[model samples]
Target: MTGLFTFGETMGLVVADGIGPLTYARGFSFGIGGAESNVAIGVARLGGESCWLGRVGPDATGALIRSRLEAAGVRTIAVPDPTFTGLMVRYRRSGEFAHVDYHRAGSAGSRLNPADLPPSELREAAVVHVTGITPALSETCRAAVFQAVETARDAGVPVSIDVNYRAKLWSRFDAAPVLRDLVGLADIVFASPDEAALFVDEDDLLGNLAKLGPAEVILKDGGKGCVAQIGGERHAVPALPVTVIDPVGAGDAFVAGYLADRMAGAAPEQRLTTAIAAGAFAVTVSGDCEGLPDRAELAALGGGDLRR
Candidate 1:
């Protein structure tokens, strides 16, 4: 059985090879980066059968993303458009501080429509995963996400949502209401502490989010670790301390790990531990999803050893 199905926009990422502005950089490296795709890749890396549904340009960058995801064992269903694909430039100074520039407006992925999705593909997945990013792309894409979620929910397939808030994309007319409605439709919700702080009002962000709707809620707090609440019981999972390399896709990695564990019938506490370990491994490596660990690597991370 397939473990997960995710839909979102994947863009070509250009990163400066050395510490300087994009204009002054001597060279660059190219990769793919997108919240939903990152989580799908992470799940695939952990031996889970995951599929990614999205749109891309009929260009080399789009071809590269499709090929890379296929190589990583993720089943990709990509709709091709004539427009140029989205591009993001990442700049780092001293390999510490970082900044990103997005050139995604009018990109191919943003042109997605509800008609692009195949009903068969949406019906076959165990869990349908989506994020706040896709809805922010465009009105058509937003409608498509709602349709996908409704289909999945109606078919008795659990829907998982990652509240990946991007302030750059949020406007007065978008975001808040859409995200709240999506959260209500989701069976499982994942949120970073900072993102939760933005939407919910409570001293304990995790607790507040659980009250919002999702049957299960996972709260990620970077190095501070994570907490999982299910059936009114809360379990705190401590973070695994590791040398930091990059923190970009850690949250996505954590979601993949947590889902993988849940698929294996692991308890909530165990799932939380695996999730934190996955996120810790993610921050220790450079690339977005490349840092995600396999099943064996995750198993080797001793329990409670993060305190060391």
Candidate 2:
């Protein structure tokens, strides 16, 4: 049993060194990536008892992901299956942008079914964090997510949802209904500016998302900062300026930081500040969740307000 629990696919990432297309790149670095796992890692780094639940291929990539997560203090509950592991290849061009090529079809995570996750494990969690991406994997995975959410809700545990909308994963027939349902059940909801724009059809993004079912809503805007609405009182927090090395996992870090602060009994305004600082710290480091700030580091960045 852990204070925080999250479940989703964790994919192996191969990022090209320097700047070029994946085909032309001669060097690559290996890492693990997934929205839920990233949040678990962030929480673990902040000294929280976080557990990650998922299915992975009984392969080297799965082993690596499990090992790395355990090393970061995250308890991993992985179901092993003999399926090809999911992989993502990232291409970067200096002064330009980065793109990802996903090879996730028929991957082990996409094969996760409700039977794969034990109800006992989910029942023991204090808070269950899920994201929109997991449901997009496959029908069985979608069912698993719904079951997990329902189980958590039935147990009277808090459920946090991140609406990480990836257009490439879902056709028009898939996303809207699923996301809408999830939002209606969440206790806390996190979404970026662009994602919020798509989910809640309003020009004033944060204002629109706040009206959704979640008692607490956080709208993250890169560089510009973040805004939160808790109990009808809104707070806006500015982003800390930092030299960014990579932008991946910033949102996950923010969610983890906010949750950690909330669990620590911090005020809503302080939680927003801590979340912003955590996200700023994440982008300054190379790996996803690697740069997530500990309490001291967070305090140095004015996140000390969390103690108020």
Candidate 3:
């Protein structure tokens, strides 16, 4: 049975080796990045069982993404599409700051449809991790995300949603209602402060979100930490202090850590502790999913690690 399940697009990442523009970079490396996939990989690294469902092109970049996720121990059920695999480029500029460029429009990932969601697999999952970005990708992709959530809800499996809203995908005014609908279906909801503000004011964000039906709501405040309301109880946790490296996948890493603890029946405080630890580690590395830590590694990180 799947302990944790996440679905969305995973794209090939091209990262510059040094601080400069993409054109002037002397060397580059490849990896994979996506909110859902990053969370899936983080869960796997923490020794939790997780599966990823989606679409990928029948091409080399797609092969790379599949091989990496499998290597990280995430179960994959990605369908093959004839279009090119989606890709993203990352460049570090002026120290810790990084910029990412997407080349994913009309790619195989955006072609996701309801047919890609397997009912049996959804039924087997202990929890489903859904994202707002998939719904904004394309009409068909939106249907697939909705189908996955409905399948999980009908199966009595918990659903977690991350409002990873991307402005490039859709306008906020257009996305608010859809996002609000998704939040209502979630057992647990995660959103950055700005994302939550898209629908509700800062003061009432958590309360207003809870009024939508989720049992839990998390508002990520970046380096300041996160505030959550779980089953009508309020909890707040501060972010772990770590030197910044790359911040791209930190949020996904946090979700994975939280899920890892939740799967183990941890208390709310413990869950957020592990989550903050995971996020701290994520920013210390350059790649999206590479910085995630396993159980032992997460434990060892409490005191810190020193490397030359």
Candidate 4:
């Protein structure tokens, strides 16, 4: 079975080089970013076998996404579509703030359909991961996420979900039920305290989410730390101290860390430790997935300078 299997829309990213207004930005760099693909790359970097299934426009941007995933050791199951690929433009408004604009409505990625999933792949996956962002894209994309989750579940594959709520994509009123249902079906769930509040009371966040049916529920508190209930046992792990370069993909990195370790047969405590280490690696670099650590890099995280 594949160590990890995921499907979602990955967009071409155009980011300004220096910190300033978009109008005055001097240079730009092009890359790809998406929740599922980021996790796939992260798992692959940590020596886990991962595959990504998705649709992309028949354009250079789509090609970039496919090439990058393959180069990172992720198997890409990409389908060509007629609509244009999605794009995200990001620029630092100031030293402390980054502004982002998405151009995904009616794009090929938002056109994902349930028919695109391969049932054979779902059946052979060790863990199937989904994010709430995909369902918020469009009705067809929403159906696709459900179909993927259901197929994986029926095949006895573990289902993992990240409640990656995006205010720009949907309203809380519209997203709550869908996210709640997904959480109910997931075997493992990842959510922030804010995201959990969409379904359950904040007083007993993880407990309420677990009542929804997941065997494991994790509340990611960003730099502070994370709390989780796995197999009915509570585990809390503090975040590692690291310089924050860009926190864009840290959550995905954390998910990948846990999933990779779980697939490698690590205990719950060790899984949390690796997850924290992976998140620290993500924030120490600028691009999404660029700093995801290999086993060696993770081992050398707090080590002193190398001897030549």
Q: Which segments of model 2 are wrong by more than 4 Å? A: 304-308
The ten-residue window of minimal lDDT in model 1 covers 299-308
Q: Model 3, poorest ten-residue lDDT window?
A: 299-308
Compared with the true structure, all predictions reach lDDT values of 0.84, 0.84, 0.87, 0.91
lDDT of 3: 0.87
Clashing pairs in 3: none
Give me the displacement of residue 106 in model 4, in angstroms: 0.8
Instruction: List the pairs of residues colliding in candidate 4.
Output: none
| Candidate 1 Cα misplacement greater than 4 A, ranges | 303-308
In model 3, the runs with Cα more than 4 Å from the true position are 303-308
Candidate 3 lDDT over residue span 1-308, tens digit each: 56998888999999999897677899989888899999999988887889997789988899988898898999987789999999998898757577889999999999999988878888888889999999999999998888888999998999999999899889999999899899988899999989998887668888988998999788887799899999899998888788887887899999998887788777788888888888888888878889988777777778212110
Q: What is the TM-score of each candidate against the true structure?
A: 0.94, 0.94, 0.95, 0.97
| Per-residue lDDT of model 4, residues 38-59, tens digit only | 9999999888899998889999
Which model is ahead, 2 or 3, in terms of TM-score? 3
Model 2: colliding residue pairs: none
Model 2 lowest lDDT segment of ten: 299-308
Report the lDDT of model 2 for residue 70.
95
- Ranking by TM-score, best first? 4, 3, 2, 1
> Residue-wise lDDT of candidate 2 within 92-200, one digit each (tens)?
8764587888999999989988998778767888778999999999999999999999999898888999999888899645787888789888889988777776667
